[model samples]
Target: MLGAMSIDLVDLVYRFRKEEKEQHQRIEGVYWVTDLTRCPLKRTYEFKYPELTAKDVFSPVFIMGDLAHRGVESLIKEFFLDAASVEVEGSREVSLPNGRKVIVRGRADAIIDLGDNSKVGVEVKTARADLGIPQQHHIDQVRIYNWLFSLSYSILFYVTPDRVTQFEVRDSVDEEEIIERITSTTYPRYPWECSYCPFSVLCPHKKAHDDRHR
Candidate 1:
């Protein structure tokens, strides 16, 4: 036995870290659908050089968002209990025309089935301020969910301290566009993403406009 030293050493921080690592290992090779849509360049970079893409800075808002996800999940579970609804994450395999297959996955806040094998995908989010309806990036994300789950409709909810704004979107897919974007030699979308990325300094596709490096 290694003795009481090991047993007494465990603390909340250490235990949470240990468990988080174990949970991450479950999806080591797969790309997260959410992350992919946010920044394909970073996604591709991380996929190519996983070791160099370690998270360096932790944002408090990001942490708060993680906690918010749990609260939203619990609330969804309670609301959908008596109704004929499904509130859960879903995953599907999508094959590119260029002969590549990827795992596209996401979770809906709540999916209320309206009969005839139709589902409504729901996405929940917390923001510092409500900026009207869904952003284009968000619209792109839920449409991907529609592609994955064959959802008939989707809704994006942006909640703030004082108000909640929602946007409803229809099902659409553009795999050709996504495939071309991800496989491109340059970063074509969201140059500002690099400014906030931890890998900005090291990324080859990083732009001069990325002020984080300046």
Candidate 2:
């Protein structure tokens, strides 16, 4: 029974991640709104070496996050009714710094209609630590969602082991900034990104801590 359970669990997680990957599959020439949040070079690597980066491994952290997101969405639906929508799909087309146009797509966790011709985008994130409750990448992601959905404001909600908190992002990035960000190749956008990145092994620009200073 243990063996069977293990197989079932593995299969279930794999299928779930596979479906998610397909849903957010990368287009050859287009950019995802998430591209602006992470290391731009990671996306470039994904495009350049699809085979190497395509597989999704089992992760307990990701599974926890998925469950939390589903729970929160369910609660929002129950409480907010028609005023809130979950997994809201949105996209925008912007010209890159190189003069080429591309589509930037993203799905916001939830959007709440204020009934005043204004909407608020919500981005739910699950984290292990409360140290950086509102990480930069998460802030950027919510801002991009605001830009994509033309939302008046965005809320970055974090569910950590210690607490549940949220922050507001009122200002969104413009097309020019988005273009510049998407076109940049800076790897490991944050100093801590490489440690959590799947492509760190093969990434030449992976950031490493200076042990000498330690």
Candidate 3:
């Protein structure tokens, strides 16, 4: 009887692992940034909001204002997806060079069942008017998602509060430029990042660094 019980327990563990894998397959998103860098700024800002010198400029208002905007993005993207969704496959956690885990999280704004003309990934960007149709930076972001998720193609949606702009990625669009831009940053700035940029105030790169003995 004890031997039979051990077998049952092993079977249960196997079933549990299978179920977990299936559940992960059903959800299409990557949480890789978590492994990249430990974002102390977000933690510090949330904790010391009251004592912050820039409290007035940075308020809970930013949070409140984005709620509805985020809602619109969700609704539109879900509609585009119809019902079925894509799932993240591997490397959700990206480890940064500094040995910190920068939690990277992303989902398809919408996944379209293309039938025969199906594309792999779709990205939705909310932005103001007069913005360019598609930039190298935007392409790089989408390409990373597509590559990581094992998707063949990606679509870029630039949506405003009123209108929607769409662009598709193909093979011949100077992909090298996009990759280069992603790898190099000659001019980095603050006050423009969404919430994830790590080098806002404490980055020595923002100032001039002169290394002698070259």
Number of the top candidate by lDDT?
2
Instruction: Please rank every candidate by TM-score, starting with the best.
Output: 2, 1, 3
Per-model lDDT: 0.64, 0.81, 0.46
> Model 3, 1-214: lDDT tens per residue?
4565445654554455455435543121223322112322433333344233333233344333344345655675567655436433344444544454433344554455556645566665655452454755566566666645545677887656556777887542232332332233444322233233334455443444332211
lDDT of 3 at 26: 19
TM-score quality measure for candidate 1: 0.73
Give the range where candidate 3 is weakest over 10 consecutive residues by summed lDDT: 28-37
In model 1, the runs with Cα more than 4 Å from the true position are: 1-22, 25-29, 48-58, 82-87, 185-188, 208-214
Error of 3 at 199 (Å): 3.9
Q: Please tell me which model should have the higher lDDT, number 2 or number 3.
A: 2
Instruction: Identify the superior model by lDDT, candidate 1 or candidate 3.
Output: 1
Give Cα distance to truth, residue 8, candidate 2, Å.
4.3
Best by TM-score: 2
lDDT comparing candidate 3 with the true structure? 0.46
lDDT of 2 by residue, 24-57 (tens): 7678777777878888888877877777756544
